[model samples]
Target: MANFHVYAAGTGSDVQHPTIRRIGVSDVLDALRLGFEDFWDKPSHYVFLGLIYPIVGVVLITWTSGGNALQLIYPLMTGFALLGPIAAIGLYEISRRRELNLDTSWWHALEVRNSPAMPAIVVVGIMLMALFVVWIVTAHTLYARVYDDAVPLSIGAFVSDVLTTQRGWTLIILGNLIGLLFALIALSTTVVAFPLLLDRDIGAYAAIETSARAIMANPVPMLFWGLIVAVALLIGSLPLLVGLAIVLPVLGHATWHLYRKVIEPAPAPVPVKAARSRKRSN
Candidate 1:
């Protein structure tokens, strides 16, 4: 375990963050397992995932409606993932509630509203949204450069073009490379920050620093963890995004557990003894 710093609430003092337990690959899996348990045990709390499905439904409708925007759909689909940390705030609260054996409610997922961390959380959300917007713009620019002004008329045409042409292949390859960079930046900054902010009464800077430190300290396992998240999200986005109803909640809950594994709470301050007075002889 390593010591880190966090602000002591009300006392206005900084203290060592205790419980910075060493994490490993097993911990990631264990967190996922626990997350699964949370979702499976109290499935109703995750219904918001279902509520989110309608948004995907609209995207699906748009896709099939025109079938011409295939080039843009990939970016849109993947970009949907960029906002996941903020979107899953409810699930984090749910897991927190379950951890304390409090009554977890679908409505209570919005407990984030009452939290002192709301401002910081809002800032994180804004940061993610900005990245998402940038990614969309960059992706469109790349696609435009590759295709010139011609747009695909259907899904079949887009796939055929993307698969058989040099421009298509290059765009796919380059687009993903750029997206990878964006994903890494997002992951390193946030993998633990969101949970940390929610779990503690600290500023966003400390939360972000803790998250980055965790990544730097455990690169290998963290890389694997990132891979797991990317793959899980990609798979979840399939099937009309309905799979997300299950995948998102599990990952959301798992993230809280992972944060617990990666970062420890600050140790309690040791009280100092007052010096003995010379009045003993008197």
Candidate 2:
């Protein structure tokens, strides 16, 4: 197992090697612009490729008749679970590699969705599912307890009823607090970890720790990035969840680039020589 370490910004640590570039808002925006340019450079290709999963996700969530929370959960998780970063990973790698004038095929990025990286992807998928479960259970549990007499129907009714009750308010506040904490922890690493694993062929633990170190070193920028993602997600939740079709893919590709920016790839190790050579005589 590879040893991983986290460091504060300006810590002068080996992991915080000079090769890793710290980024800011402008850097992120520039990357997005470049990604968009790459996407549009071959508009029909990306549109055809990108639209499949997101469209299905939007349709399922929009038409599902259930609690809004549950409705959102089923489709989003389904899309993520099936695709599991396979769709946009190639686009992301291509975009990054293009910057270096390296020619790459879309299949090259898709290839990361193979054996070794699969477990890391699964871990992330499970974490997302756990978060979703917490959200649904808490939201519905509070709704049930608070609105038993009223029998709230719509999402708006459930939210209104919950806000009006002490216990409900407590649950909402606590849930948000807990969610924020998890979000912070996740944001600190998820941006770089997955791509690092794919790009470096490193194990999940090393990738995660390296990602965490990158975030710790650049806390302010990472916080801003997290805020941007959160706001984008909230906005995407609007338009009856249709906006997610655009937002999710854009962010997914952008995150792959972000990982490339922060986590310096470890150098290939030199092999050790044998102490002595044996000779055979006949």
Candidate 3:
């Protein structure tokens, strides 16, 4: 058997040690389906937390409509982006702990806010914001170049025009292609890396490398998992943003399960003297 140990943090003497266990593709799919069922069964919990989606959406729409909205919305956006992952960490922990028949709470999950994993959360938030900025800037630049108008084209117009143009088609295809690549990277690592950091007290780099190695070692299963996530996200985007609430939470929960499956901590080493002594005694 391939044995490994993962050093986890905040695990009190009373808590069990975190270990990496072998997992399979069927396990990943089951976890995803279970997470969705859990969400559906307890819609109230998500509904309360998910209100932020629509509220943020409204604020963003208002901001786009030419209000001095940044004053109010920018901070909200940043906070939402930063805190969203932190919040998801708790859900992840809860799901795992629940599976183990351990006690867990929203408060416990919230503790991830102060954990070392925060850096990874913050980095992801920054990347998301950067992507949003790039998309906005590209749309505006294209509009300016195409229409020869100084005023920024509305997001709706930009999207519509791009969808209709050859350039737009190219951009769309290219964007999906790039997205697929990143999704593979993300699928391989993000699930295991973030929670592993929280549980292991390890740095993000080590967690990421460990995750990558796990992916490399199990390419077929990881590829299948990545494709599943990509397809789900694509479907989610079809309904505009509403699909995000369900898709995002389900993905978040499913990802926690995937992490559990892919990462197997190295096993503790047996002492050579103990082995020789045992053989002699036998």
Candidate 4:
């Protein structure tokens, strides 16, 4: 077996991005199918990782259940998707290893720490984290504006107000529009970035540029893919967020497959000659 630490380290040159391909709707569906297969084949391997989503969801919801912060619950749930690429890093690693017929043990996911692109990955992750934070703050501000700093005494009351009031409708419209912008930014930048990094040593800029290029090349398909993700996340969130344990793993695995479909194979490495030994001076 390949060393865990070296798994998913891209063999391509750090300066060059792999060629990008134009993928179609069929390709996206196939990627999801393959991703689901990966998840099904070794469901137990991902149980630990899958559970993290709902656990974090519950924690965030609980944390926001107090004070005026309760208004943040919806934003927090939606904002969770913004941080998904980072959260799914391990799933990417698992899928990569499975593609190579390597051991797909859950622990191997941690091997991402030793990847050649770890630094670049960290940079992108930090970018996503910043976006999430910005989204939370924006959502909170918007809620405060709609309600004039009034606190919802209970979840039921919040739901009723949001469903019945004009201000609530305004919040929904504006929030969805702003959230769409954020989602587009995340999708365009990260659709292939984390996977590309895991597969290659290319720097953050190149991986991100390649992802943007992929989006540009296949705008319709990319938009459809984004919609699919949004819908799946919404459904997964309905059951007290517990369904995310299954939904997230499937999406995470599929994202890796999507990257495979969008980016062409890395170019073959050029052979290098060994240096000649110098004879000792007489």
In what order do the candidates fall by TM-score, top score first? 4, 1, 2, 3
- Backbone clashes, candidate 4: 2
Clash number for each model: 6, 0, 9, 2
Error of 4 at 218 (Å): 0.5
lDDT of each: 0.79, 0.57, 0.57, 0.88
Model 2 residue pairs with clashes? none
Q: Which ten residues in a row have the lowest lDDT in candidate 1?
A: 1-10
lDDT, model 2, position 41? 58
**Superposition TM-score, candidate 2 onto the true structure:** 0.67
Query: What C-alpha lDDT does candidate 3 achieve relative to the native structure?
Result: 0.57
Instruction: Please write out the lDDT profile of model 2 over residues 25-98, one tens digit for every residue.
Output: 77677656655666655555455556665576665555544544542342243223323344456566666666
For residues 61-83, could you state the per-residue lDDT of candidate 3 as single tens digits? 57655853222232233223323
Against the true structure, candidate 3 reaches a TM-score of 0.65
How should the candidates be ordered by lDDT, best one leading?
4, 1, 2, 3
Model 1: residue 168 alpha-carbon error in angstroms: 1.2
| Tens digits of lDDT, candidate 4, 1-282 | 222122233454345657878889999999999999999988987867988999999999989885457889999999999988898999999999999999999999999998877878888899999999999999888988888878889989998889898998999999999999999999999999999988987778888888899999999999999998999999999999988999899999999999999999987765443222222231
TM-score of every candidate? 0.85, 0.67, 0.65, 0.91
Question: Candidate 1, 236: how far from true, in Å?
Answer: 1.3
Task: Judging by lDDT against the true structure, name the best candidate.
Answer: 4
